[model samples]
Target chain A: MIGVFRQWLAGLPAYLWGGWGAIASLLLLLAGWEFASQWLDPLALPDPRTVLATLHGLLTEGEAWAELAITGRRALTGFALSLGVGSALGMLAGLSMTASMMARPWVTVLVGTPPIGWLVLAMLWFGASDGTPVFTVFVACFPPIFIGAMQGVRTLDGQLREMAQAFALPPLQRLFDLYLPHVLSYLFPAWITALGVSWKVVVMAELLATADGVGAALAVTRSQLDTAGTLAWIVAVVGALLAVEYLLLEPVKREVERWRTLA
Target chain B: MAHIGVTAPALELAGVGHAYGARTVLSGIDLHLPAGRIHALVGPSGCGKTTLLHLVAGLLPLQDGAIRNGFARSACMFQQPRLLPWKSALDNIALGLKARGVPRAARHAQARDQARRFGLDDTALGQYPQQLSGGMQSRVALARALVLAPDLLLLDEAFSALDVGLKAELYRQLLAEQARRPMAVLMITHDLMEAVRLAHAVWVMAPEPGRIATHFRFDDAPAQRSDAQVYARTAGLLDDATVRASFGLDAPAPAAPLALAAVGGLRC
Candidate 1:
């Protein structure tokens, strides 16, 4: 078993190094938090152990998981809707100069408007319903994805287009086989950015507009003066964000770009 | 091996002239390519050789004259191997067939067979264009062109980027393919030796409203010509006062026969 473990470790030296470094940093941070907690009241700044225990209790009780699921669903719904609509519009803008000119003002307005302002407007429009959080997430995430798709289409290599024309490829074949792959290079990074913003915006909307999801739970913890529980909820949100990015987005990006060589 | 018809010339040009805005690039150009003949166009830079090829390939609209092509399909290989970076070598080769509405399985099978004939092994066929060497990329490009089974093949300095050994090998492969299935080839080159080595006839083009200055036809097959004979012919062509004046090489003929490198800059 030790021999097998050693071989496994040897096979992934880079991951091993990164994992050890992360563990060391986390331990150092926890120690600093522990030291700080000793100087303050337990209610003001809870120790790392207390926060860990609170997290463990929350996990076992299952309420935290339900809140997490609600938040995740809202964020994902908003993200999927925005990605589909934003990419379609972006492609239209990229292809037609008139469309691009018309879209510039709207995109600028959407990007400039703060998420809190949209959350307030959504609350006014949809009241206390789940639509508030979903709308907030979509508004916050759409701009980056739109801009990325537009730039991607605009910056495609001219030589490749010429080649396609010279070969007389049909329009649909060029779109699927040439344009899609090239556009993905720009679209992937925008997707990751949109996803992170979606999570944050969804929680903020939930905190203000509804008594559901992690944001609402954090509100309850704040009212009860349970600082450690609030910290635990924050940690859970971060963990979920990292999981989506690393597990889903990164693998797809690597697969799409596998044709590239360092040389 | 499939002949559409025997009587028609492969390609014909009459009074072809092109202008970019108000500036004329070519004028009064007349040329004809008979079936199964390899013709080379050699000229100084900025001559309309490439423009003429594009016109015949239907990439550019005719400005002055007319172009007639009897071939149902034509293929061109550019100076650079314009392979789609996202595609594997086999997929790049199959692209034209795919565009022509060939079924996926059959085109891929044909592409694989064509790849093997171009001296590309299975390993090379599976690689992306960037993953392969320059010579290998050229081979893929050539394979991509040939897979169409074109009746007219257009090459625009296609082998200029390759080293001598690779270029010679590709020349041999091209000649072998031509022998098996006869096709009219119109190649534009700055390399005189390459023109002599491959072309049955060579046309010398002059600039400033680019037009053919003269033409020379070789009676002997390209494979039968010796280096001495090639050099002698090259020297004879370079000796012409008009050819020298067009190239801006007005000096009296050098005591030593002109080497290929000496005339490299004169190529279009």
Candidate 2:
């Protein structure tokens, strides 16, 4: 018992300090900002406590939850549609030179063109509602996922594929065992990239086109001259996004990768 | 009892020749791998030994000749293990069966059994190929090949990356496994002693559009090849002057350089 306790004590530095290091740094930055804002123009920079109080007010009134739900729905719907369409098109483009040639110029144009342009077009097409924001999210999310799937197919090992041919693996088995395993390294990074872009696009589109969601709520607060409320909504959006990533995507990613470490 | 009369040649190559553009790699290469026997194809660098192995495995097309085979199944163990990086050692081993439509439960059990036989513990079994040391990865690749019950196994320097002791151990296990299954193996190696150690017959390939330089049946010699005599004999063959001549070395110059016959020796 003494030996175990001694061992535990020896590991105390890592346990006590390692995990909290980032949090400590963040706290230090927040405190510095609070101090600087108080000393300088308080009108321009809100203190951390003021932000917290605004956050509390928004939470108590249940406004944050409704805004969160709207934004969340738009983000998920657009992201899912992007993933589905992008993966299918990416597969075709990657597998066939003709398809790739046909899609490349247009995809390049789409990727290069700014979101503001697409939002304008989407609003014109969809008449200033959820469709516009969702379309913007879809447009932002598709490129990364498409590039990932295409690259995954393009860079597949010929040797392993030949091995599958010799073994006479059925097409479905080949996809799951050979293709999917080979593609995951490329796919994971792409998915993570798409996740971030999806949220940003959804918020931007919401602000421009919709009268609901977090971005719309921020606009409303701004119109009412409630700067504190606007900041609170912005904080809520970021917090909710982080929570979704930590709770859903991260656990799924960890589970998917566990076999990789073992293997 | 195993029926000797009913046994078939696992692989047969006749007048096999291949060329890339104008540079020929193989020419008039005739060979046969009798069922259950280990055949060693030894050659100097760039001598089309690997080409022959590939041909027999049906990986490359025959340009000048044909190879007949009785084996229903074959597997190749490359110079590198060529394991899937995303798969665990156990899963990689089971991949061949999985691809062949074997049920998950049965395939895993068979793979696990082979893994244990190949001396991979559960911890090792769970690890990915990238996480494994070079030697461990090769063992996992070997386990993958053996689990499939391949009638013809084409090995291209499978044990080259391993240490001397590990090579010897794997060689023993391979010999034992071959005995049990009566599967034919064509192993390409630069190690002369390794050739003598495991093969029933050794064929030395000559370079420059390589052909069968010579064949040695070591059946008259002891099967257990730790003997000094076996090493001496194999070393002698490895260093033979004719084998050297094939590599454009130590050949007498022609009296007249214009003749087709003299230049034909240098022809690719």
Candidate number achieving the greatest TM-score relative to the actual structure = 1
lDDT winner among the candidates? Answer: 1
Q: Count the backbone clashes (under 3 Å) in each candidate.
A: 1, 5
The top-ranked prediction according to DockQ is 1
Q: List pairs with backbone clashes in candidate 1.
A: B190-B267
DockQ of each: 0.43, 0.35
Per-model chain B TM-scores are 0.91, 0.86
Clashing pairs in 2: A262-B126, A262-B127, A263-B88, A263-B127, A263-B128
> Candidate 2: lDDT over CA atoms?
0.78
Over A1-263, each residue of candidate 1 has an lDDT whose tens digit, in order, gives 46544544454455445667767887898899999999999888888888888888898999879999999999999999999988878876887778777888899999999999999999999999889999999999999999888888888887787778778899999997788888988889999999999999988888889989999998899899889999899888988997788656765565567676422
lDDT score, candidate 1, position B58: 76
The alpha-carbon RMSD values of the candidates against the true structure, listed in the order shown, are 5.6, 7.4
Candidate 1 chain B — worst ten consecutive residues by lDDT sum?
B259-268
Off by over 4 Å in 1: A1-32, A35-41, A96-106, A261-263, B1-9, B251-268
lDDT of 2 by residue, B1-268 (tens): 1222444745777889999899999999888788888888888889988888877777777788877787888877887788877778888999889877789999999999998988999999888888898888888989988999988888988898889888877887788788778788899987767877788787878888788887767663224555565556654553555655654456444342232122111211
DockQ of 1: 0.43
